[model samples]
Target: MTQTLTGSATVDEVMAALAALEDPKARAINESHGDDHGVNLGKLRAVAKQLKTQQELSRELWKTGDTAARLVALLICRPKAFESAELDAMLREARVPKVHDWFVNYVVRKSPHAEELRRGWFADPDPVVASAGWALTSERVTKNPEGLDLPGLLDTIEAEMKDAPDRLQWAMNNCLAQIGITHHELRARAIGIGERLEVLKDYPTPPNCTSPFAPIWITEIVRRQQEA
Candidate 1:
């Protein structure tokens, strides 16, 4: 990798600086996210310390960086600079759920084309894209849910959630939980679906942590939000 660096350096030059900060222990943690090519350059805070002004460089890094670098790239990327087509292409290149999640939370949600991309991806044949669509919707409901179609979203969870792809099921379930917590009108239906689907019911959680099954998850979040 090229070693030269400057505040105004191009993406390639900044990537080289990032590569020099790689940490094997951090890389191991990143690999557990399921990307065979995962690499960790240390904390995102540290990366930000170094490349604080390289938001525009993220486009190149998104295309070329390894896992850690890509995570940094997502943090630095200017959402408005990306087109829906570019976001779609990035989704196609994502190989694991973690990467997909970052793209959805960090890039897609902030993009000018967010609404269009969400609608298009919800209907996509690709499981990852569809999962991202649901994830984006869930985030919206949790934050600013002004215009979202709550009834239709619940209908989708009721209809197709059970058979969704492995990665997609989690996001679909998240939507269920979000609706239950945020939309008092749909809480009962959401609880019913959660009880029936039993998503992650048997899965382990950290001690004292509530289960992500919609009923329990929704109850916990609502209580927490109310307390806040």
Candidate 2:
């Protein structure tokens, strides 16, 4: 039986608990995606639930720099508590995909400095960092696109997505899909751009799961929305 984690548990105890939860298959899958954690996400969240919110413990776990520990830290972290510089440092330190992604989706988005960070990271040369920027941009495209340069975003996606690293390419593709799905005025152009680029067109999607091929993705999502 697994032991229950608690907020008062020291970082060492949490580390030991994480080690005990490691699964060989999970490690292999994460390794394939440039992540090195062995804990199943469900179990990791269960551990986090037991720990609840412990800012200082989160800091200690993050300090260890273990992918699993960092994931747990992210789960328990107070998004607004981190200074912009500290968040920037964490983003840089979060080189692995899972850690980088969760940090962006879970913490960075809620920070007071999200827009500033997004603007800076958007143009960063590092694909990994740029991907985070794209993630933030996509959110804005869907929720609040008042000042965004939509045309420019499409222009850059058209010019750069084909040669981008896998993660960055995926992020750009998501932003493209968001634009097409949300903006009726730009829907045709977004679909055109997606069809021409053919990015992820051949991606193998399981049955009933929507394809990431942008044209199909945009169309399918719009269709669902209309039906609802």
Candidate 3:
């Protein structure tokens, strides 16, 4: 469903539009998943589509303390307009994995400070920050690995992956898999570290699907790349 909205919206106007678009089905699913914020308006992308300048809308949406609103804010916000400090504050305020993931993938990844934040956050004591950092690293390697210190990254994963937080470990595992898939020179080392860590070795996978166990994941991805 779409709302008939135009012009710049104040936070209150956006909230009202969100309420008008509320989807009971979506709200139920979000609640079942333990979403902290109440009602969900389902796809607000159309609304965001109408608003050209997202910075002001993003600021206003975030202040409302609603999950859907914040998601819309991520969709609309201009990554370049945000300062590193502002992004840091947003990350700190992000209370759930989904929020953090979107903020990192959508906002941080597009920002000029991506490289700096990825390195800094990977070492942060806060697991969330560290997880985002590793995730950013995975994204970076997938797109470009020109200046990355492959040896150092592998060493870090080998040394600390076993003791890392769940989210961070997942990112580390992904990074290792990415290394094996994208960097032929480092493939063997990445596979070795994955085997040593035994990352997601026995996790369940959908039928006919290879497990995300790093070795298997890396092997399958590499095979596909070669075939293509």
Which candidate has the highest lDDT of all?
2
In TM-score terms, candidate 2 sits at 0.97
Q: Tens digits of per-residue lDDT for model 1 on 1-228?
A: 235444566766656666666667766776776764434434454655556656667766776746656777777767778878888889888866667777888788888898888888887898888888888888789887999888888888888888888788888998899889988888888999888877777868889988977888888888898999
Clashing pairs in 3: none
Order the numbered candidates by TM-score, best leading: 2, 3, 1
5-119 in candidate 3: lDDT tens per residue?
5556677777777777776777677777656444543457776676655788798888776877887788888999988888888888886666777889889989998888887
* Per-model CA lDDT versus the true structure: 0.77, 0.94, 0.81
Better of 1 and 3 by TM-score: 3
Ranking by lDDT: 2, 3, 1
Off by over 4 Å in 2: none
Prediction 3 global C-alpha lDDT: 0.81
TM-score top scorer = 2
What is the TM-score of candidate 1? 0.85
Return model 1's CA RMSD, one decimal: 2.8
Candidate 3 displacement at residue 71 in angstroms:
0.5
Q: How much does each candidate deviate from the true structure in C-alpha RMSD?
A: 2.8, 1.1, 2.4
